[model samples]
Target: MHVTLIYFTIFFLDFVTHAVKEDSGYWRSKARMEIRRSLSYEWNTNEAKNVIIFVGDGMGPNTITASRIFRSGETSSLAWEDFPHVGLLKTYNTNKQVPDSASTATALFGGIKTNYEVVGVNANVPLRDCEASLNTDNHVESIFSWAQAAGKATGFVTTTRVTHATPAPLYAHSADRKWECESRMPPNATRCKDIARQLIENEPGRNIKVIMGGGRQTLKSNVEATESDPLDAWACSRQDGRDLVDTWKRDKSARKVKFAVAENNEQLRKVDTDQAEYLLGIFANSHISMDWKRDQGPKGQPSLEDMTVKALKILEKSANGYLLVVEGGLIDFAHHRGQAAQALRETVRLSDAVNATLQIIRTEDTLLIVTSDHSHSLAFNGYSDRGTSILGIAQRSKHDNTAYTTLSYSTGGPNNYAYEITNNKAVRVDPSRFDTNEFTYSQQAAIITDEAYHGGCDVAIFAIGPYAHLFHSVHEQNYVAEVVAFASSIGEYGNKENSASIFAVDCILSFGLFLTMLM
Candidate 1:
């Protein structure tokens, strides 16, 4: 009986080894298929009639990899990963190595590297310098302005407040990104306008065909809380007593243009794209709930995917084409709170939005770019097995003999050092005792501080459609705006004179290369 059992054990081990080895052929075949696809790939050089940019805030390399593993197994890829052109962007601001959303947004949209915490203005204007920001020489126009000048419909969508830093650069020129409303502005700064006020009163902002996101509190006047006014319960209304929402509606009405204001998911869905010349959606008083916590409250807010699809419907009505900016802004918020689960889920939500856009728009005439403003300090550590859960503990620390999560921040989190005094000495707490995969679980961090810091590492840029090949190498973050301008024949590259100059330069370079070959 003992001999028979030993032979059976040996047979089972052999079967398991052979089963695992069988996957090698599958991997080799998949690699060969990818090579063939690359060889047959063709560039789309058509003039980009429509431009859509997706910004995944704080989505670093570590975040992408972990999210990929979490959503699918180790070998799978996100929707944007299949983009033909991939590049790395230097995300440093003019004044800071590790950048903030405002400066990075300025670089990405305004095509200039500006001072940290400043948006839609040049580096000459320091942070919170209202006087300098008011100078016309210091003002920088973004791609939205260019698109508007070219007669293209312009719009933006985000999971954060519409006046948030990532979306602010599109229209609002602010010395301080924190000035979301008059309430947040300094008392002495009478000349400078708040970001929310700029959205309703300024040029490009007033002209935007679609404005969808949160910040009802910033736009509405302060009112007494009542059961009938559920939205005002969480509201910190503007101190100016001016309801920008009402102002926006009145402005649109005065222009004699048909417009719609949607306050919830149902209202947004009911908007008539064919008739409404403008659409403004404010679903939350603050930043929209994270993907994990979305739709769990009394009011229903649209998902990122939901907002993207609806925005595309309205923008597609323009004859001269359109420019749409969509931001997965909550990924950064989740990372700031050290919630890796929420961050990864937010990334997946972004992926879903991208996929939804793909289904609605054709790549032939549209330029779609996906990138991040900055990255977080989220670190993916350990050598776990292939099938191990991304949120699960990878291994026990050799030093303390305590288990650690695979996903952890490099520094700054509330639950950084979970420990107990056992022999009058602190020891690392084992995370395996509780459900680390829980959406609320705070990932372990190296040090506890106010929040996790933004990483200085270069972020990834993925592009598809017209002139997407422009992003085939490393570049400064500002290069993105230049490529969009060139592809769409807008901004500095819009005129025939500039196109002629570029053609002349190309011809000269070709002639030089021909002479060198003869030599």
Candidate 2:
């Protein structure tokens, strides 16, 4: 027995030694490289001509760390991890400690913290109060409106419905986030327009150069399931019977602007971005499927990276620059279902989209901000080996000798009750007996509930390009919109006279420093 134990120990040590590249010189060289880059860094203070904000709906610090490990290895970094500026955002809304997407999105896009379930409106309007929402004084403008007012183009892309909570605040003002269509609204709320209608009839929405993502059923009238409407056969139709898609096309036609619509991947690829001034692409009836599932489904939908590249191609034609919002919306959905693997994969896809954008845009003129609307309850646990798989088991519990995964949630999930009552004591089911890396597998949770909840922790922010240095410290969530507005010289902070005055002062200070250096 002693000889066998000694042989197994030797094998384990040898495996670990080979798995990790732990040469002291390797780490020292990497540290020196990072130091050299930092010492030679120069701040970009140029005025931003274009802005792109990439939001991972439920991606928190923990999720980012796990994704970095899953995508490459323990020491690997995501695309945005190399950004020069990093900060933390306080994501609480006025009404809740642990906020939802709607309120947080409103803060990020509208520059104000509002109540939960509210969008594009101030805190003065109560949630679900249709009369309160109709008051123009209670409404707040977003970055999209600012961009349009400044003669800059604007657009958005998401993995979920275009009118979903995370993207709705950019163009829609509603008392309730659920009011995506008239059918979803209460009968008494006749004065309030549905989110889809706002996107078609409102100022910034109607003028938006590009719109993509799901929610076809909300935009069209009642129709039977056909080859075209395969995904949303059971989805609820618009109660107003007005085809918003047709409305959008007619409005654009009246203005005599070049416009195009695409319902599938092939149609989208066929669009002439150079000629089309307006574009709309809706590939799913509701939220788009998870990345892996979408790949296995019909070949109609485009990946998030594909949509992002197309949007940039169209938006880049604007001579005055553009403001675009891209969302990895499915990360939140996957976390709610307790699918840690799916959530991490979605985060990686968001990173892929960011990398693609970096390839297409010039960082000298464009400001790119990558952040999260909120965080999930997903927790990273366990003391695994040097190069253990992120989805594999960590260590066994000493109390019961049951294996637990590296990723688990704080509360709620299908795996919350994954135990057996034996002899009046519960024993956690051994995860080693099955494949925990399956896409459908749910990580264990601390408590049993219908769904996992959002975490109250602050999320991370990464910035590059012009004015990136503004995000060097912790800040409120609304600071994000403020930075975008200030950098692009748009919104209330963007008057020609004020900008000139600030520029003059900067020049005076710069000249004084130059003279002192000469002395």
Residues 315-376, model 2: lDDT tens digits: 99999999999999999989998998899999999999998998898878899999999999
Give the Cα error of residue 443 in candidate 2, in Å: 0.7
- Cα-based lDDT for every prediction: 0.87, 0.88
Every model's TM-score: 0.90, 0.90
For all the candidates, what are their Cα RMSDs to the real structure?
8.3, 8.8
- What candidate 2 gets wrong by more than 4 Å, as runs, is 1-21, 223-236, 296-298, 499-519
Candidate 1 local lDDT, 301-391, one digit each (tens)? 8999988999999999999999999999999988998989999999999999998898799888999999999999999888678778999
Deviation (Å) of 318 in candidate 1: 0.6
Candidate 1: regions farther than 4 A off? 1-24, 223-237, 296-298, 500-519
Record all residue pairs in model 2 with backbone atoms less than 3 Å apart, i.e. clashing.
Answer: none
